[model samples]
Target: MSELLDNTEAATKAVVDWLTKKAKTKSKFYIKDFYKIFPDDKPRAIKKVVNKMVETGELEFWSSGSTTMYGLKGGGIQHSSEGES
Candidate 1:
């Protein structure tokens, strides 16, 4: 699963895997970070999939000021807590 991500579909798994790791630490990550992973994939497509993840509750969305971050809900992370801090 360490291979470079090439598509949004593959990226969905990669995001889940990455978030799985973060789930252990309850760490949050950013949308741009996800976008940068798939250099060949369209940025819009990546964002769309990530949004889907959020919609499906795979990833939690946290908004801090003007910044929005995403983290794994599977890890028991809280979006409200993330934004408050």
Candidate 2:
């Protein structure tokens, strides 16, 4: 059970890391971009992870008219405690 949780955490961190890197130059990205990076996961799964990240203040979302975009809460890159780059 602990292993399962660890794997989930790692996956979530990967998504966050990717978004953080992108946010450096791009002001925002669609949730679908995350789907591309993590093709193994379903959209619903990705949304769940993204929601959690937003809730934890690791990410932020914005809406431009009808389009929505997402980015890291902080402007700088955020590394996982495990030293993931």
Per-model lDDT: 0.70, 0.69
Model 1 pairs in collision: none
> Candidate 2 on 2-22: residue-level lDDT in tens?
232237678677876776676
Which residue pairs in model 2 clash with each other?
none
lDDT per residue, candidate 1, 1-85, as tens digits?
A: 2344445466678788877765666567777777655666676777877888888877777777898888777345464444473
Model 1 lDDT on a 0 to 1 scale: 0.70
How much is the lDDT of residue 33 in candidate 2? 84
